[model samples]
Target: MIRAVPVLLTWVLAAGPAEMTPLVTEAVIQAPPEELWRVLTTAEGVLKLGVGAADIDFRPGGLLRTAYDPKVPLDSEAAIHTEIVAYDPGRVLVTRIHRPPKGFPFMNAYARVWTVFTLTPEGKGATRLRVAMVGYGPDEESQKMKAFFEKGNAWVLRELQAHYPGGR
Candidate 1:
């Protein structure tokens, strides 16, 4: 039987009362940080992990554009847009989702969401990856968005783990 490991979830409130809560998920991938870094930073690697075709420019303020549905033409207005907020090669990367796909349910309903990926090298060839989705407002729509991404981010991490079975 394949036992499933529960994904860890946490919440952090911003300093002020008006601040929104941040949703965090963490996982330990059985692969080197470098390999996972490539998956997160490169278009080809991201495509291999099933994030759809991507046009990634891996630098601060660069774009990581993706089309989630292959049925939708790449040039169509269905691509989701994210910008790199900060990055440190194989260690850390921060990105903000600035634009949702056209006609998305929550399009333009909430503030931009910041996703921070921190990779820490674990024992010989393992990496602990922590993904934080922040900047959610204290509104119903924002809470819905947070819940949506909490599951989505966890699935992305699982896909990354599957990409490196038994650390290859």
Candidate 2:
């Protein structure tokens, strides 16, 4: 059971004003949108997350598969597979978990969540990256899942920002 890996998802810009606020994280990177796009849509780029191996099908309905254990094959149950929901070149990318790894906690709440990444050009070869996680239900479990993502997603964006340090 994969009880310790970060979860992923995308969709629902806002559940509703009456609902819980979505978990949104943002960072400014020292790279162009195209540069970031390359990393976002490629296997090597995702490995920056410290995964062992990954394969990306970068299109709507495509799959982004990853395994934290380098020795594990992508097709194995320990890998995580996310479905690309929608994307615009160097602009926005959204995804939802197509199939979670074994032993993943929060299956019920996990299925209802999604994640979206937005890229905006900041002056001087920099891009502002914003990630939003949405679609949480109003329940204790949902709240827990949401909290988990708030930290996980923020950490991911930080890692990405680090990837393009000092206007690289």
Candidate 3:
């Protein structure tokens, strides 16, 4: 009986944390890391990347507020607001959704997700850019969000790659 107790305790101790897999996308941008970092952290850069309008506070704990409609003012409730977390000048930028616009999907899951953007210098000044959406729980809503970003993030990465040489 004592041997069985030890075996059961060992099994329980051997169990690991819950599976947490991020949706990751990587591509080589034709620009250097410095240039790409600017594109990621500035309001003009956001607009150039096909976002309509942006008001960016480019600091840790600051906000990146954006609206998809050019005429929609940024202070309006229609804007999507994300918070800037820790960032390295030209290497990484981490952020999480602060306030999503109305009607945003997967409301139950969005609160827990964070995005990490990493830029690495590759051959000939090209930058290897990686985008990772992390912190997804194993719920149905999270699964749905996972499916949405699988297509959405890949498209954005492709666009960002094609958008190099100039941020347009």
lDDT of each: 0.73, 0.78, 0.79
| Residue 43's lDDT in candidate 3 | 91
- Runs of candidate 3 with Cα error greater than 4 angstroms are 1-19, 165-168
Angstrom error of the Cα, residue 45, model 3: value is: 1.2
lDDT of 2: 0.78
Q: Candidate 2 has which clashing residue pairs, if any? A: 1-103, 2-102, 2-103, 9-114, 9-115, 10-114, 10-115
lDDT of 3: 0.79
In angstroms, give how far residue 143 of model 2 lies from its true place. 1.0
Please count the clashing residue pairs in each candidate, in the order shown.
Answer: 0, 7, 0
Clashes of 1: 0
Q: Among all windows of ten consecutive residues in candidate 2, which has the lowest summed lDDT?
A: 1-10
TM-score, predicted candidate 1 vs. hidden true structure: 0.81
Candidate 1 pairs with clashing backbones: none
TM-score of each: 0.81, 0.83, 0.83
**Candidate 1: worst-modelled 10 consecutive residues by lDDT:** 1-10
lDDT digits (tens) for residues 59-101 of candidate 2: 7789999998988889889899999977777898988788989
